[model samples]
Target chain A: MGNDVSFFSNVLYMASNVQMIIAVLLGALGGVFVGFLPAFGSPTAVALLLPLTFLMPTDVSMVMLAGIYFGANFGGAIPAILVNTPGTPPAFITAIDGYPLAVKGKAKEALFVSNFSSFVGCILGAVMFYFLANVVGKAALAFGPAETFALMVLGLACVAGLSKGSIWRSIIALAFGVAITTIGIDPLTTVPRYTFGKIGLYSGIPFVPAMIGLFGISEAILLLQKGKMFEGDKVEEEKALNTKANGPTLLERAKMLPTNIISSIVGFVVGSIPGAGATVAGMMSWNLARQRSKTPEKFGKGAIEGVAASESANNAASAGALVPMLSLGIPGSSTTAVMLAALMMHDILPGPLLIVEQPGLISYLTASYIIGGLAAFIVFQLSIPLFEKLMYIAKPIIAGLVFVLAVSGTYFLRNSLTDIYIVALFGIIGYLMKHFDFPVAPTVLGLVLGGGLESNLRLALKIGGVGELFTPIASFCLLLALIMLVLPTIRSRRTRNEESQVM
Target chain B: MNRIVGLLIVIVSLAYTIGALKWSLWTEGNPGPGLFPVIIGIIALIAGVMCIVEGVIPVNGKQTLIQGLKWSAFLVALTVLVVFLMEFLGIAIGSGLAFAAVLTAGGYRRKFLLILIPIITTVSIYLVFGWWLHLPYVWIQ
Candidate 1:
């Protein structure tokens, strides 16, 4: 109890700092702006801003970035609910129910619920960060090279699980990613592996350029092929689409409280695990809610419960991602991975000694999230009508705008044309992969985890001796990967046999 | 398309593994540079082989590999074009062109879309990176 009070007071003191306050407001504003824009998102935003952090105080810069990180999640829900276009990846699930609600003239209700759920999730996550910081930090300290390697393998294996298509294809993508990671200098020997005599390849594949190519450029191509799938102008024609005019009544809002609470818990738990983020949480929650609901058929048709479940889970996942990042230095999602990078840039090592080293920093970071969430909720609610109006704009204009932003953002990273080329190259790769039902996310996951896995594996082998490669931790991770790889094959065969029988 | 992709990956992996084996798989005092790459190459080779086999042998009425290739060409073209442009024009200009081209190709017919999207996107990015944030612009020069 005494510790809690001390932590609370420390947070208050940190928040009172004029510099920290300014940082929070700036980050929150940046987050909202990026979140509202379809092309701009947290990772790109961070990459664009990475250079600037070199000039500012590490703590202030990190706090500001963290604020933007959470703020984006909060702001992302607006476009998703009103326009059916997810401004960020986490909001993809939100569009499932949110767009339907908007189509049904329940846009205001969707907006309200989204904001409310976001606020609830942020607060819950902040509380967890504050109370459990010490415990998590200590646990993180115990993780060594072997455990880290295992964790990476587990993360890569998840690609098979999360992929919508054949697991075999996903594994192929994952392996491709791992292979790409080996293109630069060898971690142990410092000798070049697949650089092909190129100086640029010495550093391995640059993350920002590769990511821009993978997510940003690829998406543009896909969207272009589909030809303005989001025609917001059609919304104006539907007089029944004005959700604000016929908002949910107070009693109805009250009834959703229980659903929101349950979904938030589900989001938080799933989010705290490394690799799983809002997408998984949202899908899981929505599925559970549908299973529990009396009318499961209403799920795809704009059910209020669906909106609540998805929104709550996604928002909670945003908060939950912080858990592993703060405790173990392992990012729970891509966005958090960027955040971890930001922290590293600031020289703030996020591990066991983090709290002891900077007592008030954890408290302040937690408080900043709370404040950011509240601010985002208020700002998002107030701008609902305006955003709804923006959705009526033509699709061509939106696509054009998004493409430009994505390109420019990629250019900003390291100011190199090489990066731009990488983006373009990946964009094509991303597009082709999609056309052939080759999943892009696994590639991204592979890119993100590939370097880490290889480096750690080498380091662990060096430290533990060649014989130690078969240690419990390494063996365990390998076993898990084998299971992940084999299980899908078994499942697919069984399903095929069953279908043949039915035929 | 699947078969080509698989074949390309397999060939690349096999070539890289052979190169790595020649360079150094293991040394007496320290681990060789080729060790990790060799492992990754082997994995890639195996996966590529599996993918190719799957492409060759259909499981449940999936599209033929050649059918997949036709659809993938446009994307590959777009990628190659962007990469070439990025080197000559720089990131901002190259990206703006790519964006405009892709969006236009995507069926965005409005004249305003082409003009406004590029201008707004370029200017806003300039402000964020060049003016407000003052990040060093490497691609432009």
Candidate 2:
């Protein structure tokens, strides 16, 4: 009780103080601005701001980063609502109902519902992480390489299953992603695998460059192909929605509480899985809410429930993603992976030890969620009009700017020309993948997990004989992975049979 | 389209398999470096074959063209231009020029805006990535 009181008091102090509050608000603002741009998700926002954090106190610095992470989800919903395009992967689900609502001149209402639901989700996720940290954190320590390998398999399978009819394409993309990481010198032995005798290939593929290329440059190329950014003649209709008074009343907003709560719960669970990330969590939440909705026909047709379901789930997922990283030293999502890297840079080893050693630090970081969520809501509400105007920035201008940023942002990471070429190659690949109806998420996630998966598999086999793979934990995870892979196919067959009967 | 993509993947993975076989596969009880690559190669091959099979499967639903893009050729050209320019003149100038070029390609003809937008963009990038972030390169100057 004493620790709880101190924790709450410190959080209050940090949030109430002028400077820390300003830092959080400013970080949230930057997050929103970055999140509004295509391919500039929370990872980029955090990566860009990581250097600045070194200058501040640990608590303030973490609070600022927390603000940015939470703020990004809110910011992503704006462009997704206003434009049919998603700024971040999680926002992809938001765009389904969001764009339609914007088409119906309910942009402000969607924005309001999203922000409000995000707050609720943020609160629930924070509470879960704080209370469950002691129990789940311990279980996480028992996971070995075999377990991790199985988990990665499950992650990839889930991605393929959720590809929305592009399962094979997603699988191919995932395979290519994993294969690409095999280049450069092999970690186990010094032998180079796929270098083709090039000196530049010795250091392995840079992660950030590939990411910026796959997401940023591909986005630019896609925008160029689309010919225009936003639909014209809808400008006047959009203007009507921009009116401050056009938002939903408090009572009407309260009605969506049920959907928001359900989606948030779903988001929290999905996010707890390593590598599952916000995209799946949010997607699952949105789908579940839609299924449970009384007026199913209203979904994907300017439904407020869609915005609530998506926003709540993704926001909650962010906090859930952190639980594993903070406690067990495993990254639940790529964004948290980046955060793990950042924490390591600060000489803080993130595992069970840190939780016991630095209880105050952990509390401060957790408290940032509550404070950051409120800050994000305030910042997003104030900046909605500015973001809408950003939507109108000339299509070519945005395309050009995105291309420039993608290239330069990638190059700056290592100052290597090889990085530039990788970005270019993957940028083209990404564009083609987009053109070919191949989901890009699988490819990126595969790349993120490639090194870790390979090394883990080898390490597990090295430590224990081949039989180690059959440990109860590893076997259970592998069984779950197998189910993930086959269950989708079975479901699709069942759906086909049911349709045939109906016909 | 499916067959073409599938064939491309198969060919690529086949080439990779040949390269990987140069390394020893199994060393003692633990697997060697080549083992992982072999597994990756097999996965690629399987996915490629699956792609081919899926292509042949008839569908009653809408089929969107995956690789059919009228602007693809132009987009490729723009990508090449940015990459090449980035090598010679540095990111700021290269990106400025590429920005103008892409704008023109996208059918934007506002002469002053094109010129002004690039300058502003380059300056902003230099300020953020160069001056503030201390990245190694942004402007040649």
Q: lDDT tens digits, residues A1-503, model 1?
A: 11333656645754687887777666766777677665556666555555655666865676667668767887777666765545666665676678788877778777778877777777776777677666644554455666667766765664554444356677667777677777877766677877879998898777556655565555555444443332454445356664456557789878877777888887876677665567656766775676577875566577888778877787777777787787778787778888888788666788656666666677767766776676666667777777777555544455455455555655554566566567667666765666666766567667766777776776776776666566776678678767866665675678779989999
Model 2 TM-score, 2 decimals:
0.82
DockQ of 2: 0.45
| TM-score of decoy 1 | 0.72
Task: Point out where model 2 deviates above 4 Å.
Answer: A1-5, A51-59, A76-118, A228-314, A324-353, A497-503, B56-90
lDDT of 1 at B29: 46
Please list the residue runs of candidate 1 whose C-alpha ends up more than 4 Å from where it truly belongs after superposition.
Answer: A1-26, A35-40, A43-66, A73-121, A228-354, A357-361, A380-395, A465-482, B1-6, B29-31, B56-109, B112-114, B135-141
Error of 2 at A103 (Å): 7.4
| TM-score for chain A as predicted in candidate 2 | 0.80
Lowest lDDT block of 10, candidate 2 chain A: A225-234
How high is the CA lDDT of each candidate model?
0.66, 0.74
Model 1: what is its DockQ?
0.33
lDDT of 1 by residue, B13-127 (tens): 7987888786775577445667777887787788778878767322321333233333235545644565566556544555566567655666666787667676665665556
How close is every model to the real structure, measured as TM-score? 0.72, 0.82
Give the worst 10-residue stretch by lDDT in candidate 1 chain B.
B57-66
Best DockQ goes to which candidate?
2
